[model samples]
Every structure is written in structure tokens, then in C-alpha cells.
Target: MSDTTNHQRIIALEAENAALKARIASLEARLQLNSAPPQSLTHTTPTATPELSAEEYLRYGRQLIMPQIGLPGQLRLKNTRVLIIGIGGLGCPAASYLSSAGVGTLGLLDHDLVELSNLHRQILHTLAYIGRPKVLSAIDRLRAANPNVTYIPHITALDKENALEIIQNYDLVLDCTDHPRVRYLVSDAAVIAGKTVVSASALKTEGQLVVVNKPTSSEEGGRGPCYRCYWPRPPPTESVVSCGEGGVLGPVVGVMGVLQALEAVKIISSGALEGQRAPASANEAAAGSPGTEGPSKPEPASMLFFSSYSPTPFKTLRMKGRRADCISCGTPSDPALKITASTIPDYDNFCGPGPDAVLLDPKDRRTVMEVGEMIGRENVVVVDTRDETQFGITSVGGSRNVPFVLWQRGGKVPEEFWRAVEEEGNSADPQEEGEKGKGTKGKEVVILCRRGNDSQEAAKMVMEDPRARDWKVTDVVGGIGEWARKVGGVVEY
Candidate 1:
């Protein structure tokens, strides 16, 4: 060949070589034999609905017969995983029902030990298990109710450190804890984990129930309003009362807890209606993988309030959906306000200072022993701030009943009521010089109730009143319950 012909032929051969390399690369991609991992196709894998065994059919026949809950609903319940964060009054009843109803996996978490006092409301912890870790005690009782159900007992407290990880493992969470600080933590952690929360609280004869962070629509970026959406800030320290202090009716908490399970069943069943069936493997659901799931379900009522004493019980409140400015569930107003595992705010601070921190002023409080010592002092006056019924049930020997509600009315109560209260305490000590005693006449006022919480709040009210400003006012620390325990059980609880 000539020099020019040979050059052209060389170019053609190089081009052919390039085409062969391109074909080889294409074949490698098709077979996924290259170094890079193959891309997954974007599609949902449908979860199959599980069927009931012969024994399961007979055991759940009553519920299965209901139209709202048939085989499909039962299967959904069997597939759903729930975590109950406290095994106290609310947790006991909630765990009981959820287990019997056949929830696939139930997680019971609590750091507290069972106590004698808990027997009245914490039904899951029995005399046999007293002094044991609450989660262990609760799990024992639950397993007896339904041995087939799997139970996960977390003996440690749920805090920011373990909350997100634990929460992400379950499909739903139950905020059965009594602490206000934990309530906010559970809600925030659930929001971050992309799970829904069912929360219930009971004190005295009243109870409240709410579902938080439920998905409103698959198209919506975030779930519905969270706990902070309505209660953007925690209630004032004095406004909260523990069941231990305030005293709850076991049946009242029982009612709320049972209803909490009902709400969970409803939430889970609604998903089945939308064709979001249970995963074939329990491991997949517990891992919270969207491995095989369908669209989200609308949330139930925003809130429910039940009072055993009310003429009409069980009031449902409608929600206004998610707030545009919600701190946890909304689009952040400030870029720095975003909440993540690392960015969760100090829950204690977000819930505000607790009662213990708020009542640190020396002049504002008296110990139970100090108040008990004042019982017979001629000049010291005791005011029982509980309602007439509670005061009648138990009270200090000589303390006069002045319902806290009358004082909280903020001048709505007649001036004569205060005068009468003061007069009762200042009854004439005939031995004193009339004019001299009258000048420094006001009695040192010590306010007390069942627990110190209400008494502290009442004491602050008394100190703020212009009419009582001259009075040296203080709350009884630990209130009558403490006084009873420390001072020979003089007061009834």
C-alpha cells in the first residue's frame, strides 16, 4: 500500500477498535458485572396480608366478627409494632390490651421499680413482682395475657440518647409516661423518627388522650400536628400534678389506657384499608424499612378528654391540622431551628423549669416537719387548699378549708370570704393586749394540699394578693402526704 492509503486504513481500524470497546461496556452494564453497584428500580414492594391460624381465629373470633376488624384488620394488628414508654398506670392498661389484641411486637420501657402504691393503678405489676423493674414486671403480666406476642423490655429510661434509635424501631409509640419532660421528648423523637404517637395522661378523676405526628397524606412532606403544635410551651410548673400527688382513680386511667389501644388499632387498621399490608418478615417492620408499604392513613381525633365525674364523658376535639410555625413538625422559620438526632433541644428547658426548681425561694416554702411543728402554735395559721370534698376526706387537725378555686378566681370571690378565713385563724387570744396584738395581728399563713404542687401554687397566689401581702405566706413542702408520713400519719390520704 502507498503511505496515504496506509494512514486512512490505520484510522478506520482505530475507529473499529473504539466501537468494540463501547459494545463491551454496554454488555457489562446490562449484566451488572462492572465494579459499580446496579441502580434499584423505583417501585414499591407490596406487603402480603398475613392469615390467621386456626387457634388465632377462635381466640380473636369476637373481634374478628366486627365489621371494622375482620381478617384484614387482625392481620394488620398482628403486623403493627408498638412501643409503650412507661409501664405505670397508663402503660399497664395500654400494654394489656395491645398484647391480647395480638400486636406483633410490644416494647415496654421504664426505669422505675414497682412500688406498693402502684398496685392501685399499675395493674400490670402485681404483688408477686413488687420491687422489680417496671418493664420486667409489666412484661411478665403481658406475656401471661398472650404468650404468642413478642415483648421487648427496656429497663433504662427513655432519653435523648436512646429515644430516636428506639423509636425508629417501631411503627408507633405510646407516651404513657407521667413526666412532662418525657412527654416532649417522646413527641420530638417520634417526629424525627417519622412515626406516630398515641399519648394519654390521667390525674385525679380526669384523663386526656391525643394522637401526635400522624401522616395526613402521602403527598404531605411531614405528619400532622405534634404535641408541641398545640402546647408550644409546657404548662406552668404549678399547673402539673402527678398521679402520685394528685391521686388518680384506677378506673379513670384504665379507661384512658384502653382507649389509647383502641386508637392504635384504628390507626393500624386504616392503613390496611389503604392496602398497606403487613410485611412478610417481622424483622423488616421492626427495622422500620419501607420495604413493602403503601400510602399513609389520616389521623384519628386530635384530642379526647374523659372525666369519670363528668355528666357526659368522652369529649372529642377536632384538630386544625399542622401549624405553619410548629417547632418540631413544621418548616423551620429559622435555618438553625431544625430538629434532628443531634439538634434535639434540651427537653427540660423546652418544657420549662419544673416545680422543684421554681419553688427554691426560702421564704416561699416550709418543710412538712416544720409545718407539722406549727400545728399547736397559737400564732401560726394553716390553710387547707384542697376542694371541700378532698378536705373532708383528709385534713390537718385544725387547718381551715379554703378551696384554691376561690382564691384562683382573682377577685371574683367576695372580700367577705377572705375576712372570714383570716378571722377564723385570728380568734381572740384573750390574754393579749387588744391594741398591741391588733397592730401585728396577721397570722403566719402556711398553705397545704394533698401534694405540695397545688399548695405551692396556692401560696404564690396568697403572696401576690394585696389583701394578704402583709401575711407571711408559705407552702408546705411535700404537703399533707409528706406530713402524714413524717409526722405519725396524722393526716388521711
Candidate 2:
């Protein structure tokens, strides 16, 4: 009886072991199936249109080798859509590589038409393409590089009306706009869409790129902070010269744009890995291996600046929300400082008491904000030569617009534009005349522009006048835009 019972027990144990082996085999097979690119994503399905063909498979064959971008990774790239909001400087290069890398769908947007000047850094617009839309130029260049991708060109400038809808369809956004106002808009839109934003900027000699997304917005396993999380409000605009005006080295923008592309690819690849149902291959896990992982890192979600000059690596700021005493973004949330892009106070409001004025560009050479302050006297006459529209756009402070364009073409007119300049000179007291007061004729004329272009022209026009020939005409080479930034010039929409 004991022998029979033992025999039965042995048989039962053997059956149990066999059952466990079968289960393990089934799981392994399922894992392989899970790792494959979805049929719908890889091949065009009637329900889910695949964008690639046999030709594309051969084209991207090399990229498919690395585990991260293997067959599965390539499919993620094919399904992803990226919106590049600026096609100049940084945007040019960013769009180029993303297209070269075969991003499935690409959106090109820019309001400006290409100029011969853009050719220095913007490789997309050839001499033949000059005077053409930047968006169209970028699209043509991108398509010429890779016909496998789909291109959408937008000639309209990016504004609130289309910011959300246009940005929403994209899995990622590239903010390559030149203006500070536009940058702020891009950051804000990224927050609203909860999409990955690979923002980059380049000036004279610097470039910067960052991965901005929140920690709970889907896509990647964990949502990361958006650009706004870093700079809740646009930081005080800086007094800087444009590359077009200041003169940038040809390759600087290219470097920055390439970096932007690198970040975008990383964002897409990261999202694919997180969304996958199965474990990635050993090598696949190491791509885009950033040192830090989550929100615990300081400067949670914010804007980052990069310089082209050596020794200046990366500067990122995570703007805090609704600070009690903060200005701009912080104060508005406070309800006390409701400053916005559209509604700033007048230039002559009670900003600082005691009848004081800030001089922006005292010298005519290049950037002269510091010179203006050094020689500028108290309660003195200030002459800003920028046009009226630019004056309003930059939120010009303590200055009147005697438009250089008008003065350049006015042919001696007596309009409100000229009256303001003459009155500013006549109102100042004579005793403090040497540095502060201007001889209605010899007074230091402060000329400015968005970049100092019109201002320089204005100064030249003033010098051309026989009556003001000997008069001192100072060109704030960096202009009011720089002035507003250096002297804390606030911007209204």
C-alpha cells in the first residue's frame, strides 16, 4: 500500500513541473510578439494608414539596427508629428535634421519671407528661394532631403488664434521664433498641449536646447514639466542684438538647430519605450540616458538658454508660480500686477519718481546701453528714433517716437511725430545742459529701433540736416528692444 501511494505522488509531481514549463514558454512567445512594431503602425492598415513603403524600409534599414530604434522604434518615429514654429536660424537646422531622420509628419510654420541675409545661417533658403515664405522654404528643403516624410507649410505668423490647434496635433514642438513674445507663446502652448517641447535659441555666438514637458501628461511613462513650468511667465526680455543686426557666425545657428533635433528624437524615442508593453532590448534601454530622472531635480519646468561662445554651457530656470512680491508672471497671478503682452502702461507713467529718464543707446557703434546711463543726466531730454509701431511693440520706456523712417522720408513735415522730439529738447532746463540738456540744436539725440537699424538711419538723417549738422546724434545700436530689456523695459502684447 505504501509503494502504490509513493508511485502516485511521484506522477503528480512530474505533471505539475510539466505544466509550469509550458506556461514559461507561452510567456516568452508573447513577449516577442509584444516587441514588434504594430502592423497598423509599420504597414498601412485600411483603418490606420501606414506612411512607409518597402523603399522607406530600405532607407531606414541602418537606423533600425540599434535596439532603441529597431523595427519598433522606427514605427514610433513614423507615427510622430513635429511642429517647428520658426524657420529661421535655429528652426532651419532643427527642421532639416528631423526631416533627415525621417520624422513621419512635419509641420513648418513662419510668417517671415526669406531674405538674402538669412542665407548665412538658414540653409534652407537658397538664392533662388529668397523672398519666398520661410515656411515654404523649409518645407521644400526638408522634402528634398527626404521624400518619405509628409510636410505641412504654414505661412501665417504664430499667434494665440492658431497656437493651440496647430500645436495640438503635434507630438512635439520646436520653438525657433526670434521674438521674445513668440517664445513666451510657444512655451505657453506647450503647457496647454501637454506635449514635449524641444526649444532652442541662438544669438551672435550662443545656442540652447532643453527637454520641457510635465510629469503627468501621458506619452512618456511619466509626464514631464512643460516649458512654462520652467518660465511661468516670459522672463524680463533681455537687451540683446539680433544675429541679423549684430552679425552671427555662419555655423553657430546650425550647431544649435542640430542640438534641437537631437532632443526631439530623444523625446520621441523615450515616449515609445515607455508606451511599449514589453521590455526593450539591452542596448535600447541606454539611448538618451539622461543622468536625472524626475521632478526632484531643481528648476522643475522652465526655459533654458545656451550660448555659442565657449565656457557657457547651459542655463535653465524653473519659474515659480504666483509669487506674492514678484513682477510680470508672478505678480499677475497675484492680481496686483496684471501685466500682459497686450496691455502695458504708457511710456511716461509714474514708474520711478523724481523726474528721471533712462538713456538706452548713447553711442552709435553697437550696443551702448551702459554708455547711455553713464553720460545721461537727471530729468534730461531723451530722443528715441525708432518707428511708432516698434516703439509700441517693445514697450519702449521713457522715450518718444520720432520715427527714423518718417524722418528719413518726411521731407521736412510738421506732424505729431516731429513735435514730440522738438518739445522733449525744448522742455529740459539749460543749467544741466552739458550732459543732460541739448542745445535745441546740439542736444544728444537718442536714436533707437527694434535692432538699431532704423535708429542708425535716423541718426544719419539727422546728421544730414544742415540745422542739426553739428548736433550730437547718439545711436542706441541695440535699440529700444535692447533698451527695454537692459533697463527693465516691460512688454505689452
Candidate 3:
């Protein structure tokens, strides 16, 4: 066949596929409407057998054939409801898998709007959803993937006031949020509501996953530990790094999100849903014989760590059982530790405010415009403190790259920086001291980074150096980001 003919055939097949999906969605919607009990019927008798349409069985046929997830497991999955707390990188892929796997209902909760930056890691969001709410964006894509599943969008941040109420509606919760405060809030709320939580986080090339508050039989060492059980208190605020600030690989987060969905599926299929047991047929399939035991129970809780750069990229750390004195899940000896809807502790106060970016005073800072005007001037040195990779992307015309990492841990300032300053200072004429004294007597060292935060610290470090006493040292007020916003030439990323 000719290349053009093949291309045309491919497009026609895609159109046909889309039409079929629309028809399936319409049929499913009509089935649900027809099956729903009328409002006039205040109460109705429950059916002995749960309903699973022929379309559903065909949709999940591959997984249904697996002994681990036989007919009984499919029914359990069809009855499960899961709530994902964030619709960003982790939530996007996790929600995609769970909904496609036949989870009956999924609650997507997020207050953030879709952005150009989120497209790389957040798989469900597309360019068309750029400024739309993330939950709405996720719902549109997820519904198309599986029209039989129900999707609920909560276009608001999960706060103390509504955390428990919202979480109580779902059978399981996924803590895919980025912030520590919100993570604590979600874990606490899930524990308080007696719901299992699958939590995961990724930053840079590393990712972490753990199943917290997993339901267990009394013989299986009681219930798994809650989030607070592992960490009695939150980590220091300064140590926390957001994906926006520290940077994260797209696939790294996607891996963690997909794993979270897998864990949720395993937990649900293992008959952890409200102590409901799998049917005898499922037990027989799992046991490889009729009249045998039911499906095996969930594995003990353990934290999973993955580092793409490591030779052994995956490691499982066995987490200790629940801490006896855990404030969130421990004995209610202390009423303050017990979290209620009205008594949920202020997480911001508990975790402390995020790292402050403003450390230097007004005199030590220069606006991006001031720095822009001094770009190529004689005896004016612009030092970029971002990592070498970022500096290579795009930088000021005459700026010298001196990464901020070199200044950390009592490390000495790079000699190349001093050499650049000396070379620029040598070009200045002593006779130019009258009106151009700014960079004549000594070089003016202006530091900058992607954001103003690091530049402020870099400037403070430079100013404290005795060698910089004779030179005018200052940082850009908002770093390169400000330059991109105010001045037109520079690229922000």
C-alpha cells in the first residue's frame, strides 16, 4: 500500500474508535439511569448479587482471568471507591489506572489549575486544560478512558474544616499531594475516618511509596501504622523541597503514581473492604482447587524507595509497627492528639511556615532592571548562582556561572568568580570615577538564580566575605524569573 493510503486508513480507524467509545459511554449512562431506584421509593430491598454488565466483564477480561483477581476480585473492585487528594503528577496516573481497573467511583480533589509546566508529569492534563481546574481536566480524560466508572470532582483544597467529611465518603484515600502540611492533613483525616491510605512522593530522580493505615485482620498484626506513626512530628520546614523548586523527572513521579494504584488494587482485591470476604469461587481459584481457602491477605506494610540513578534502583524498607505514643493513631490519652473535624490541629503551625526566601535587607538587593542596565558595563560582574545545567540553558549576556552549591557547607568561593571580577575591574579607567564610580573603583558583583530566594542567600554569603568589602555586592530582587517577567529578552525556565 502507498504511504498516503496507509496514513488515511489510520485516521479512519481512529475516528471509528472514537465513535465506538462515545456509543459505549451513552449506553453506560442510560444503563445507570435505568437501574437507579426512583426517588418515590424511600427504601428498597438490596439485591443478593451485585451487577456487572457484559461490557464491564469484557473491559476487565484480562485481569479477571488472573487467579489473584478472579471473578470475586473483579466484583470487589467494582464496589470500591477511592479518593485521590491531588490531581498533579502522582494523582493523574494513579487515577487513570484505578478508574480503568474498574474502581466504581473515584473522587478527585485539587484546587490547582492546569499549567504549562504540569503537562510533562501530569499525564491526564493536556494543553487544552492549561488554565482549567485540574480535577475537571482529569475527569474529562479519565471518563473517556472508562465511561463505566463514576468520577467526582472536588475543585477545592482539602482543609481541616472539610477533610474528614470528604474523606468519609470514599473507601480508600491516596495522598498524592506535594506539601507536608497537606500530607499530614490527609493522613490524619483518613486515619480518623478509619480508611486506608496509599501515600507516595517523588522529587528529582528519587521516589517513595508506602501503604499507610492498611486494614488487617487481628492475626495479621492488627492495623498498619498511620502516617504519624512513622514520624511523630513533621520534618523541618527548611528541608522540604517542592517539585517546582528542586525539580522532578516526569517519569519518576509517574512510576510512583502507577505503583500507588497497584497497591490500592491489591488492597481492595484482598478483601480488605469492610471485612467482606471474597466468594467461594474466588477462594477456589486462588487455592487452585474447589472448597479451598480464600485469596491471600495483603502484605505487611513497608516503605518503597526508588532512585533512577542508583545501580539498585529499588529498595524496600520494612517499617516498624504503629508507635504506641503516636499522636495521631495512638491511645487517646491526650485529647489534643486525637483529631476530630472541629479539633484538627493547624498543620501549618505544626509543620512551621515554609522556608523564607527573603533574608537580605533592601540595600543589599537590586531590581532586575538595575541588573539589566549593568549587563555589559565595564567592571560590573553578573554572577549566576544556579546549577551549571540551568546556567547552560540561558543566562545574562556577560554573567559568570558560580553554582550556589559551591558556597554551601563552608566551601570557599570559586576562584573563577574572583578572576572574572578582577578582569572586569582592570578594564575600568580611574578617570571614569566621577559619574561612573559605581563600577570604577571596584567591580560590582551581582548575584542571581532562577528565583530570588537562592540569590538572597548567595548575596548574604558574598557580603560576609572580607574580600567583598571593597566591592559592591548585591542580588537581583527576584532573580531571573523577575527578569523574564519585567524585561522581555530573557527566557524564564
Candidate 2 residue lDDT tens string, 8-42: 56545534443454345435534643564444333
Best by the lDDT measure: 3
- Candidate 2, residue 354: CA error in Å? 28
TM-score of each: 0.75, 0.55, 0.77
The residue-by-residue lDDT of candidate 3 on 153-174, one tens digit each, is 7777898889999998788899
Estimate the lDDT of model 3.
0.77
lDDT preference between candidates 2 and 3, better one: 3
lDDT of prediction 1: 0.72
Overall local distance difference test of candidate 2: 0.58
In candidate 1, residue 47 scores what lDDT?
25
Candidate 1: give its CA RMSD in angstroms: 18.1
Between candidates 2 and 3, the TM-score winner: 3
In order, how many clashes per candidate? 0, 26, 0
Superior by TM-score: candidate 1 or candidate 3: 3
